[model samples]
Target: MVSSAGFPDFTRVVSKTIHAVVNVKNFSKKYSNQFDPFDFFFGFPDDFGNNRERKPQRNDIPGLHGSGVILSPDGYIVTNNHVIKDAEKIEITLNDQRTYKAKLIGTDPSTDIALLKINEKNLPFIYFSDSNKVQVGEWVLAIGNPFDLNSTVTAGIISAKNRSLGILRGETQSSIESFFQTDAAVNPGNSGGALINTNGELIGINTAISSASGNFIGYSFAAPSNLVAKVIQDIKKYGTVQRAYLGVKGIDLSKTEYLKVYNQETHQNIKSQQGFLIGEVFEKSGADDAGLKKGDIIKSIDGKPIQNIADLSFIVGTKHPGDKIRVIIIRNKQKKIFNVILKDLQGRKKIRTKEEITPSELLGAVFDPLSKESKKDLGIDYGIKIKEIRTGRLSAIGLEEGDIILSINGIKMKNPNDVNKVLKKYSGDVTIKSIKENGQVYIAGFEMN
Candidate 1:
């Protein structure tokens, strides 16, 4: 016979988790009359048959609501980037129904984490658990304000980890994910909240749930605490993440069977059954500088055997720029060694300068100095016209074939030379404001070392 008293009571855990959940309400500007190509070609009204006279104008203010978790004793909160993105005003409500204005400290969309600060201090916060130690069947709790409901607490167990479902903002493939999948119910307003373990320790941040009907269908994912800690620390110190780059492009063996066959035929000396094949290395990149070539098969990095492209990317992301690492490569049935210094995605070596381009290796883009005609037509005093977007940071950010740069970090662009000069002056995340062909303005920010 089992004693019920010896069993852990989850009721207390739920109560504590609820206390950490917060209500985040923000004011967002709703842009009405947004241009639609389909509607334009068919000659439909800008509102798309909505009763414009009866409805409020498009530029009217809209109330945006979401959830968050108290991360510190001094009123520091963490939430989703999409939840508070472009918010005009942010107000936080506590478990006691007390409200206070919150200020955005920093945001990293790569991991969908945002840091916010409230006016008050000595607030109650939940401590983060070691997510790496959490097992798949361990009990967990999710706390958030879902569907405008305040401080809701749901219970479940860890379902999976290291999940990469490819549901992230922006079109580019980002390298910030190690999700802890859970069965806890999560919804739209639950973003930026807490996912806790049995002991009331935060293990992950509730992010996304997979469903066909736009509701929880027994699958949910949270950003693991390890990655969340990195993003939070980076955003606090540098206003952006200092992501490390490996500089070599490759495909995963699971995705490409030819690479597997090539590995068996070319590298007989290599003992490993799986590793990354070196594709094209960027000129002057860290890998190229380290003597890595296109034909070399990466056997190991820093003593860890490379299993696939994801393994390579994960290992590279764990390093920082200027850190020297040893790479083992098998080339032409011969083993070799290469010492490489890691670089940022932009291929920069240092963190002090804002200019981040090797002019000779611009990576397939036709850039010209800012011209008077370009600036006048774009309705900006400065910016460069992106004539083409080859494969690199620019192309990754959805800067298609003909986007025009308006500014970098709020500075006006004068030309390509001006863009380069201004870009080199900053070292962390740089926001590029540009206009599309349809005259719609969009901003893309990238981190440079």
Candidate 2:
């Protein structure tokens, strides 16, 4: 993959992208807690009750290394959310050996993207290319500080397009995993590195790899640059990600997972060649408001064919709240298109302003009311399911992501607002009854602040 005459020379690309790739360090001093009420959310528990008799431990995170890509000359940098999650301090080292502390602007854990800013100006940055236009088998380069080796470059061809590895589920409930798969030799410390084309345009962010031995195994994935660009724009415009939702839970028609849904809903034999079928729709959501029913099959979005969840995410994930989307669906052997105005998770159109921001807004989580079928299955009449948890007070309180909140201080929790309103108003010990992913019900108490 060297530069040569009469061909796409990658040397020009390496020269342009290498300057924007930088090393990232996450510093934290909190001691790791030894608890696992819910095994998934906390790598280690965030809290261990009010006991203060334990001895001080070393920093939970120190000298943790990763990679970042510069997005602007004014020092705006983009990296993976996991790279900076729970970081007490962040440091960025440029290729020229200049180091500066970075300010975390905001993060979209759903997309596994984070935006950081530094005080420096006139910094080298990279331009984003239309990831949609990137074809499979295109020449690409992965640049990062892999294995603490700064300014490392690896070359490969894009092996596949629109890949979903279910990597983002743990960080954000609304996982968007439309990744571009590559054979580049990515490894540890390459989480937020740049994936660029031969033209020197950023095509994706090198994120994760599929390896059985904890290293690259000829397969890797990257968050598309188009989505990263949209995430960056949202962080700059809104304080947090203004994720617009289609609000329906279903399965891809081609997968075996859709059989259970098909049996339960239609009670018919598994038979479908194409189109995504809806199993349930959230109330008051754009899909529900647009008259999209559970039995409907999604045909396309904005004239683009919807082949799978990744395709759906690529289109809707880039849109903001209050934006209108045209959804084409097939219902009872009829094709229909509905113009739907996407709304925030709260089913509202208002965006949070700086002055109006509150702790609830800072609570990076999404809450959905328990469906009747869900309540019946869980043997709970009232509760709210936490769809996802990014960061904020809820996460600090050890509220495991995706756990259901059954009650607040012995009061039945009905909807998302109840959890938000209580967390916003109460400042003391709050007891919560909830259901875990393992179907175990338990009670937890923690301070609101």
Candidate 3:
């Protein structure tokens, strides 16, 4: 498809895919008290000069603008979670300039993908391509809105695969970072946009750019479509991602310096220059059940070569609990193959529904919104009561029954649902402000990761 001048013609791909890319706007919940031009130009209220905070109505201005891809004809849209994160309202504008309010269906912070639904029907959508077949140097197109420019299209080639830049650290500690690296000119407003191949098939979702000056520096990353599809399907079916865990902590052998230190500390010379070296295998984990152990080097999965942690993570991430994989590893310089079954976070082999995986169930506790009488007694307007504590994170952290949860990581817990929302999306640096059963204030901090 390369033209005479050596440029692959992008006309056909852009024409079909551009229409499915929509503009996403995140509206702020409250307006700032900063000097308002309207108030400055007109007569102010008598209390304008008072040193008090006023809860203003919703702001009309969008706090952030990004691009999203329409994934289904019946109004399913997909975009980066950060694009609409914390927004009081989400607005979607189609290519025809028809705007509609979008409802957030679900979000998977680990993948940075969110599912949205609008009321309209019979819309254009993009089809998912086999991202596993996407190769380096393949021609591709980046379609999105950048700096308010609608339906902008850019051309590039896949520069690399299975790249992990740790750009998703803010999303979650268990973040999946395997991405397709490209030089596709993605910019500020391109997050949640489409990264399609020359055949007009969606290969990835453009998520982040690696740059120091906040502009494209010939490096952009996308969450591969294979993983995106799995996440979307889970969200649609279960209202949350059915994340599977391999539960093995290890070091990538490709990093020579770290490998050398590991070799010295472990008192062994691991000469292999590539693959992931297992440092610890959690008990009762899939890897442990499959007979995988410490000091083993993972060489492949289902015959695909494992070059680093990214490769291993990506292959495992695309699968759900109860899925089986063929894993090959090197143990004592001898190759060994094992059939491994993945497990969910609760170390179960069955898929869990939203109710089964609730924050209360995961934390081994029961929560309820603070009673009116309790709120009046504590002189607090918001708190979630831990009605009972079982063997979960709360109990492990010393929180007991009748404890009141005021906040986590600075976010107020107004109800049990608020606690679920925060815990579902966040990991690492857990700080909980609560009240003990004795009416004394209590706070607990720990590293969840």
Candidate 4:
């Protein structure tokens, strides 16, 4: 809409959508500020070379604030997972000054999305638009709380799409990062806000801003609304994201270095410059079952052109396991079409049930493999860090987040799967040795059966 002065006016869109944008505050337990994974700045280092002072403060810590978008009248809200990570209490405040405590439904760190629920009805909600239909150079309004300012809205145009920044860290290490790059003014407190079109339809969720100063510069990124909807639906119905995997590893050929390496290693003179070159095809995977071999360049999937890794990851990340996808690849300069049935990480072709959760999952905690730097700093060779603590055995036993799991029942915790392998077979006594985030050693023993 344009005003009488011939300028684009977003007053109507703001009035319709701003009511659904909300303030999300996360309250965490007090602890020493010693390199918290959740306390970093948009997945970057904490200080960012600013040479900020590091001083000890009081034990009580104030709640951190962000933004959220209401998706349903019954109080289903969506926000970035990092906003509420490791939070003990989540508070939601509506635009009309109403507040309520929120319950965490589920989280998918791969896409950096989280679902929350509150007991409220007749609440205002935003409508979701097809993000695939969003085009560049289109006007968009960013609605969120920036610097604790409530109901703030900024307007800009979509600058780019399908951008991957390698910021998100998922459990499977295959993070979905197809972001809508915009010139909208998104900031630290706008992590989970809404990005709506002129029609007041939500096209994306404001996630991260590419700024060394930890504020809005010239560009910002948002998670596409289509991907967010699929993730939330899976979380609400299945208690987890039904992540599908094509079971192949490759390098983006658009880069000069990767292209050179592929041609030299395979002794092939391939000249394609913008397709994903297959490095290894896992055995018994959907790609292998469909006769997709190594050295094939994937040109397209389901008729959509594959330009790079971001294009491929975003397309497949939205699909569920057991879904068949049409894949077109160029092998020896000949186009080949293959009907590939996607599978889960477990190699299953069916939907997974909540009851099928592994023993480690039943503990109500998320575990990430400790980094090499962290291992060396803690003087431990192998351990898994407790990323988040929910309501379960670990939390009930007073185990806090950021505690390292060195070993369980005398078996070294090398990978996340190791916890499941050990606990599933033993039913007697259980013992866990670990180190706290403060460098204190802790050991606990309990009966399993």
TM-scores for all candidates: the values are: 0.70, 0.76, 0.78, 0.80
Give the distance in Å from residue 18's predicted Cα in candidate 3 to where it truly belongs: 0.5
Residue-pair clashes per candidate: 15, 0, 0, 0
Which structure among the candidates has the greatest TM-score?
4
Task: Name the runs in model 3 displaced over 4 angstroms.
Answer: 1-6, 30-60, 354-378, 385-449
Report the Cα lDDT for residue 167, model 3: 56
Q: Is candidate 2 or candidate 4 better by lDDT?
A: 4
Order the candidates by TM-score, highest first.
Answer: 4, 3, 2, 1
Find the candidate with the highest lDDT and give its number: 4
Q: How well is each residue in 79-161 modelled by candidate 1, as lDDT tens digits? A: 87767654656789999999998776666656667788887877889888777688998888888987889988888889876
Winner by lDDT between candidate 4 and candidate 1? 4
Q: Name the candidate, 3 or 4, with the larger TM-score value.
A: 4
lDDT of 4 by residue, 179-257 (tens): 9999988888998999999999999999888765667778998999999999989887866778888988898877778
Candidate 2: regions farther than 4 A off? 1-8, 31-63, 264-266, 350-352, 363-449
On lDDT, the stronger of 3 and 4 is 4
